[model samples]
Target: MMRNKIIEMRGIVKSYYLGTPNELEILHGIDLDVYEGEFLSIIGASGSGKSTLMNILGALDRPTKGHYYLDHLPMENVRDDGLSQIRNKKIGFVFQTFNLIPRSTALKNVALPMLYGGVPRSERSRRAAELLQLVEMSGRSHHRPNELSGGQKQRVAIARAMANNPAIILADEPTGALDTHTGRLVMDIFHRLHQEQGKTIILITHNAELAEETERTIRLRDGSIVDNRMNGHYQLEACNESV
Candidate 1:
């Protein structure tokens, strides 16, 4: 079956201190395509440009030289404000740190993106409640970040990421801070979302075992793709088990 392409990046080059002796290039040149409703993982060691690639993929940063089409929109043509709008509308980010507002309840945190997107007050609350329930966080909807366990906080963060019903769920080491068991629970949520909701997911992680759980894995080394492998029923018991 032919699938729609959700993300396409070509000749992506990221460099710092352009036109100077101190210039340093992170990503050499990357070409990537992510299909709609596909769960893909990018795995690499630290300093291997995983973070750099992710920033570009998430539309948080632009490549110095390259083209990126997100949902078929040419990203290089978007202005700063337009990029912000695109991020809010098309890209959902779930980070390792669970970047929640300490002062806000889980429901409020999940509703924040909607508030910024100009969703009506009543509508935002209704949707936020629904998202929390989706992530199994409805019971903790009234709790603050400090009051929730790490796993619960991460779940709430995941719920928040789904607030805008983005075209892509970009998860950056979503389970990095949790225990193996808790992380498994979080990973299960991602699998469920993919299988049930047909969500397009891109997971940036270093754990090869975790990457295997995805439909495909792309390995990066020294700022270049080293391997692109379709994972066929890899064992799940070893996924970050020793972390």
Candidate 2:
């Protein structure tokens, strides 16, 4: 069967301070394709432009010169509102900070995406509860972020990412802020999600060890793709080990 490409980016160039004397270029003409249900990782150093690429991929920012087709929709010329809608409907983000509302309960945080998507209140609550259960945070549903551990907060963020059933789950250094045990557990959740839910996941991290666990790894260097390789093996046991 021919695999469907969920994300297609070609000649993706991102620059800042355009038309200014102090202009700087970040991503230097990137080309990438991610198929549906694939587990992929992009690993890079501090100045490799991983964040810039991610922002463009997540539709949070536009590229200076490039063509990005996310789920077959052209993202290059999309308006801000259109991009916002695309982000809500097609992309789920899991950030290092967990990005949950401090005052909201875990359930409320998980339900926020659904709320923005205009899901009915009854259905939203039901799905949010289900997602929390998926991430093993059902018991903490009523607790706020301040009351949760780092791992717990990350799990809640994961649940929220699944709220809209997005085309892709973009995880940016998801395990960066947790302890070894907690990070391993978080990684396990991602592995389970990919195997069980068949989520199309793209992980962005600077850890080479973590990147190797994914099905494919793309290495960036100074704003350019230095290496792109398919690991073929999932390395589940290896991923279970600490990074």
Q: Pick the candidate with the highest lDDT.
A: 2
What is every candidate's alpha-carbon RMSD to the true fold? 5.2, 4.5
Each candidate: how many clashes? 0, 0
Q: Relative to the true structure, how large is the alpha-carbon lDDT of every model?
A: 0.93, 0.94
Q: Give a tens-digit lDDT track for model 1, residues 1-243.
A: 457999999999999996779899999999999999989999999999999999999999999999999999999978889889988989899999999999999999999999989999999999999999999988999999999999999999989889999999999999999999999999999999999999999999999899989988999999999898778753342243334
- Candidate 2, position 28, lDDT: 93
Q: In candidate 2, what residue range of length 10 has the lowest lDDT sum?
A: 234-243
Per-residue lDDT tens digits for candidate 2, residues 1-243, read 567999999999988996769889999999999999999999999989999999999999999998999999988778988998999999999999999999999999999988989999999999999999999999999999999999999999999999999999999999999988999999999999999999999999998888888998999999999998877455553355434
Off by over 4 Å in 2: 232-243
Indicate the worst ten consecutive residues by lDDT in candidate 1.
Answer: 234-243
**Pairs with steric clashes in candidate 1:** none
